[model samples]
Target: MDFFRIDLSFWLQLQFSARVALRLPAAPRSLRERTFLVPNPILGVFLHWLGGLASGSFYVPYRRVKHWAWETYWLVGGFFSWIIAPWLLALLLTRDLFAVLRE
Candidate 1:
């Protein structure tokens, strides 16, 4: 209903969709299959740009939190951005996530 909830929901959905998409099986070997397996340089660049934009803008939401001390706001934001979101995303995206982490 609110912006935080909406944003969180959107992020969760997007991550889940990405994980599902990435899990699709590759087609058997062929010219087209080889082409598909090759990472597109343009798409790679675009993804990096998008990630930079997202990281740069991550603190924008904190600006709307009035009456909060800077440290309080920053710590709260940092916990979500650095800890919670990454953990949740990794759990969603990876098979044997705990095994990978343990290694």
Candidate 2:
């Protein structure tokens, strides 16, 4: 159903955003030395919010996609967002992206 699709999209976006956030480098020492509003933490929060908004509205743009069935566009976008992009990003950020999978 539409509700289930939306929920799945939201959860997938949250997971992807969390992975991206956790992979980010630590804040600069000068910034970290501050007592409040640490840069990286704040950045993570902002990115999460933006991701949530994008996820909620993902179907809107897909709706306008011409010559493609709903399932086709949704699957294509989901594949890129949830799998391909994550794989490529993880490879760049982590020394061995598959190391976590070995366990």
TM-score of each: 0.49, 0.44
Clashing pairs in model 1, backbone N/Cα/C closer than 3 A: none
Candidate 1 displacement at residue 62 in angstroms: 2.8
Candidate 2 lDDT: 0.66
Cα TM-score of candidate 2: 0.44
Clash pairs, candidate 2, are: none
Residues 3-58, candidate 1: write the lDDT tens digits: 22222211122236446533334433442222113346998999999999988997
- Cα shift from native, residue 2, model 1 (Å): 44
For each candidate in the order shown, give its overall lDDT on alpha carbons: 0.67, 0.66
